[model samples]
Target: MFRFTDYGEEDAIRLCKELVRIESTDPGSYEGRISEYIYETLRQELGADGVRLCRSEVLTGRRNLLAELPGSSAPAGSGKEEPALVLICHMDTVVAGEGWSEETGGPFSAAERDGRIYGRGSCDMKSGLACALTAFCREAGERRLRQGEKAPEKYRTLRFIASVDEEDFMRGAERVIRDGWVSASDWVMDLEPTDGRIQNCHKGRVWFEAEAEGVTAHASMPEQGTDAILALSYFICALREEVAKLPEDERMGRTTITFGQITGGYRPYVVPDHAKVWIDLRTVPPTDSRMLRELLGRAERAATEKVPGSKFRILLTGDRQSIPPCPKSRLLQSLRQAVREATGEEAVVSLFPGYTDTAVIAGTLGNENCLSYGPGKLRLAHKPNEYVDISDIRRVMRVLRCLLREPLR
Candidate 1:
């Protein structure tokens, strides 16, 4: 067998193909075996030159890959010194969906057709990981100088963090955020698939659950006990109506609410005595999660008033997303300039509809001087035939490389 890293650009396509070959289908882990392959490749093929692998302490169920390349021992960032930059992306994809395309052999089977690399997660995220790693390696190789030789006066470091658990739960981002694990990097760049546009803002997320309890009563004797299903249903409808009334802002888009999950009592002979439901909400900027806590409180009250015989309670217990607003810092301007120069396209800045690890780190860092962009196409993510254009991959690689050489403002 041959190593994928030793091959040329043509070889990288095949490497991606091989990656798609793994049946990573929810074997209790999102990254599956492919992440382990990348981890091993980074350690062996990429070699020890400037690469440091740090495992994720928060997510031992799945691991995070943190790689840092120290540019120089210089202390300051680009005003008089260049500041360090961190590149962030995730490693997990949503669990495979059923009724998938047969030709792709259930999503992981990578197939090449008409200049596209086809497979699950090929677009949603895995390709962006390749883009960042390739840029880091190419930049390092190009900047090497002899012991006595002096390279350019650049004095910044670059860190790449490949995270896990971004699909179902955001614990990966939450854990890192709570720990303040990142060294004070001058800035953060989330490499999400944006079709080359810079993603500057993203909406915040909230996940909520409600439970209704009632005394069990036989189907033949309805008057003997209360029905929990009635109580829960009342809350569900009222909550949905309230969510529809959530305020909408012109810039960040409207608030969104969805009934993600619901459950009721079992067996046909007995009336349902207990029920629960999960609600997920997306908020425009400035809509604090305190709003959700209040909303749940209101729903509990509404259910109790509607159904006296039954007990009703609600809990807002899930990972909520922190917003990273559009930054106006010099580093942001530098990035935009590099992006425009590389693509000849003006950047379109907007908030991401989904959550990411960058939000966590940015929140803990206590600032909005952060930004995220990537090569993965957003529409095809987690869909039937997920794939990323090879051209986008090369274009982003060039942009990241150019960013290393440009003088910071």
Candidate 2:
């Protein structure tokens, strides 16, 4: 019957494996290859004019792939036009760190075992991307069918955006918003792995560098130079104390600080004149970059004051704005209904503990009609032997199928 539901488990598994086989890691890496593959796939389905590869001028070789499919016209006498729906996915995965070896298979091998696909990006997001892409294509084909066989009116337009640089700065998502690729009426679904649940709220992230400056001197004359390392140590301690006082949220969790990296001193013989520590802060609502910066300023003032003749500078590295939990919206209601219809179970509504590109899509972009719902376990992301269950992939596809059919309903 040429039904959209024909896009099944095997298809999703195959597509996910193919995507995982390509190593699209972040930090000095680009999403050109993966974005091109997606563009070609959509072009083959909807012709060249329907798909486009948008490269960012700021990030060379990093690309954002976009595909659009127009929906059916409004029914006669109804005079109601459907709102557009945007399917969003990131094209980058965290760096595949050490621990991947031949014994466990390569990170990009995409090996199948125990009904799961083993690879670097499998659990983090590639499976979710595959499901979204396949569902979009399936619905596009249905819209192109003969007149008598067409379905009822759904969205005004279906737009799929595979954005780059999500694992790092989220500049790809910012570009999409700056370019005005979406509007207030468009509902955005960031297909990040949520294990099988639907996520309406998530924590935000702010990264900064704390630099401690001191005088340089020979190691033998330790008292002659203000030790930058010791000054930074004092700063770290003060930062710990400041973060401890922040309030906690039951769902979104508490604001926490992580000292990711530290660098100082040239050699053992010389007291370093400069030292810097990278701090990553995970903040809940009411705790944004500005508030966090103020806390850091306090820490810096306390530390530098304690260690006389030492100066500290707080530089913001990156920020993902925070938003409170959204009220009951049409998009969330439709997604919950889709999950219920597809899995025969009420969707589990919860908050995403970690950061996601949804922060940019919903918070920075000012598009409140956004949520994260997809396949794979959130715990498995950025870990060794990351994998996504094939059954989960199929379930996500089924939910998306229902979403495409009756988005507004």
Candidate 3:
């Protein structure tokens, strides 16, 4: 059996700091450097034969890494096959925006203070990645040690995937699914900073860009032309009203909408000819494409009626469907058992408000056994002075060790 020790905890923390220092900021530095670092590190730990890197088809010059440990077969014609377990972590983080505290050095400093690791990706996820890596490598090493033993315990095949572009369009995950690296029967878990809770369901997401068009006019002739900015404002109000009518869930809460970005008039002296607003909708069940279309239609009609000659257009930029909750899943039961053995406490089940790579997997591949559970708080992700407690990483490592050591039916 592979056991986690004090030294292993220290090594996991160190690995997290190194990952944070690599600067894999999405839409900024990109994940090339960090991907290379992870590929090299896994290669060294698991050997070249056990690890492979695949270049992303969507993102240029970026790659995803996969490391595998094959499982032993059932003994003496028992006619039993072990299931495969995939551990997933994204190698990309959101851009290190402004508002960082000087005491933490910088956004990529990966500083340690009072048992916390501070950096851009520290809390959002690098800590989870470190824990998963440590657990996987330890198990692989133990399997190697038992090579010549007379009777070693049979275990499930284990695979660790480090994907790219998770903070953006999730192209890496799409590629992983397209390449058939993961099947619908395989158990998958994404380390997405769930604050140590197992998130069995995820909120659906849809990104929209609403454009309002009107004739531009000079400030002196206010009545000569319509204002697109005013029309957009009306559209926003109508959209909010429509969104508020959507159904709510007890676990996932009410469907929410956020105006991420808006642009209107160029100058105070002129009536703008065009205005656009980017909207994000986080939805729950019973909120499907037909409902979205109906809501937008109602909002557009209300806006155009209020502002005559002003046309409104809505575009669907992205859509990620929700994963319904599976409280009685075998994967959840296994994880709960692992948590009990590791921490002597019952596991908490919850719903993730935001979307994740596992959403892409479940949506695209119809995999219901996938879930997210890891170190750090989701609230601290993509924010200034993000940090993860060292103790949290250790706790997650313990849970992962217990999970890896057991057999998944």
CA lDDT, every model vs. true structure: 0.69, 0.81, 0.85
Worst ten in a row by lDDT for model 2? 49-58
Model 2 C-alpha RMSD to native:
3.3
lDDT of 2 by residue, 141-258 (tens): 6766633554644455788888888888888888888777666667888888897888888778889998999999999997899889989999999999999899888778899899
Instruction: Give every collision pair in model 1.
Output: 77-81, 77-82, 77-83, 78-81, 78-82, 190-372, 201-351, 202-351, 202-352
lDDT of 1 by residue, 1-409 (tens): 2254533354445555665665443434466465677677667644676566666644555776777777564554444545567777777777767667766556776776666777877776767777666666555555454323655655467777777777767676666555444644557777777877777666777878888898777889977777788888888787777777777777777878888899988666677789999888887755667876777677777887887778866777764554655567655777787778887876777777776667666665654666777776788787887877877776776677667667544
Q: Please state the error at residue 301 of candidate 2 in Å.
A: 2.3
For model 3, state the Cα shift of residue 273 in Å: 0.7
Ranking by lDDT: 3, 2, 1
Winning candidate number (lDDT) = 3
Q: Model 1: residues >4 Å from true position, as ranges?
A: 1-12, 23-27, 76-81, 145-148, 151-155, 175-185, 319-324
- Report clash pairs, candidate 2: none
* TM-score for each predicted model, relative to the true structure: 0.88, 0.92, 0.95
Task: Report the CA-based lDDT of candidate 3 relative to the real structure.
Answer: 0.85
Model 3, residue 397: displacement in angstroms?
0.4
lDDT of 1: 0.69
